[model samples]
Target: MSVRDFAHFIAIDWSGARGARHKAIAMAVADAAGGPPVLVRRQRGWSRAEILEVLTDGLPANSLVGLDLGIALPFADRGAYFPDWDQSPPDARALWSLVDEMCAEDDHLCAGGFVDHPQASAYFRRHGAREGARFAPEGQTGGRGRFRVTERAQEAIGCKPYSNFNLVGAAQVGKSSLTGMRVLHRLGGRVPVWPIDPLPGEGSVVVEIYTTIAAIAAGRTASRSKMRDFAELNAALANLGSPPVAGDGAIDDHASDALLTAAWLRVAAHDPAMWLPAGLTPEIARTEGWTFGVA
Candidate 1:
């Protein structure tokens, strides 16, 4: 089916926790012609089977899905960086090398690095990594052919993971919030994932904040320069908190703060001059270019 024929898009923010405090997958859907996105469902503490079922049910044929978790690409052969979780785990160096190679080869693939290093481990502590760091044999990384996945790859697989691709400035300020918005915007308005707080009854104000930003970003209701719009919106919706709305109470400044940070990232990704709050290096700013300004 043609890209235009694809009717809906879904973004899944995954979590491994089990309880009321656990996050549910946040979902947003938009029509092919481009319109406002609607929040369809938010389920807290879903199981793998539930997630899979949601994936299968929500994603119609020809529709695209952008997931927060990694999907493993089946190797044509095996490589040096493959994680040996069953025996010896791969080191940081090996994992980095593999990521560097993969990223250099494919623009669509993201290199999050190997999961063995202290730094890498910290970065991906929540999201699980793939097993077997050993590289597949020559031509295994899909050098010339299409990447393949085994039919039995039902388990959470780790492949060339994709980053949020938000503007760099946003990434620096509120990485999670901005990245989530960027992914949602790119998917044409699909909420990236569900949000839940650490405490069982704490509630999910943060999720609402992110989803609101995603909706606004996708809807073009606010621009990169007008972050205050999001702030004001959040302030207005502070009460009536829920999966898609902030609880009723005093306005939460945190939402505005995060959205502003993300807005700066979006601005910087498009025009470096818009970057503010300082401290963002030229190198980091340059990397931000890859994620900004795609409709």
Candidate 2:
């Protein structure tokens, strides 16, 4: 489908915190016709379940939703999500299903158990003073530092993407990605997640996006990952012909990411090159899903 097919553009900055409401989660919406991207209010913060309901229940028809989270792991490295594990999933869908099943009983769809699992502990860096230490690998000093081919391809464009396997740092996106897998599991059959599932004949479509790529496309530098200044944020929005961000209090980095990403999507959605990058092969699409604006 084309960018004109959608009536609304929504960008979500998701959090993986194990709580009912998370202030880190931010959402922004913009009309396809062009206007300021407005932040969706959350007086008491936002819950993952609530966001899922908003998308699944009833939303504007033909909306393009951009979610800021890694949809899949670095499968191109070992050609599998979890190498040597008997329970290693073969594809992105299977990996999501396994994670959902493993953390099915956890509250708020948390994936703590998956990361803490004996078999999976070696794959991620755990929190605490002894950072970068890997478990089950027997005295390994550092956690596995790796990236998927798509991530490398994204880096080629000047955007630095964190490895989905690193979970210990402040900038780490591993936790969010793991929790997002559960969300993707529930979003199944409701909205077709781009790359993983083909674009639907009609209705909304969800695509994986890196807010940094969106920020860069909107003329922001790779070094300045966050935009707290109102002028800078609005200038980026103005570059896409979207409305400026106006609010009462201070706008945090998360909100700026969502807002700017929404604006970038408004313009980038029209470009066919983003939808079909040369690296997005049938194999990569099935194993490691491509980020929307990576190419």
lDDT of all predictions = 0.29, 0.82
Model 1: per-residue Cα lDDT over 1-295, one tens digit each: 1112234444444332222222344444433444333444444443334544554344554333434332222222232112333322143222223444433432222232223343333222222323221322333431222222221121122112122211123221112322232222233223222211111122111111222233344332323312234345443223212112333344323233333323222222223222221322332222221111112
Model 1, residue 204: C-alpha shift (Å): 30
Model number with the top lDDT: 2
Candidate 2, residues 215-277, lDDT tens digits: the string is 787777799868887888887777777777676446799999999998888888888888888
TM-score of each: 0.32, 0.93
Model 2 local distance difference test score: 0.82
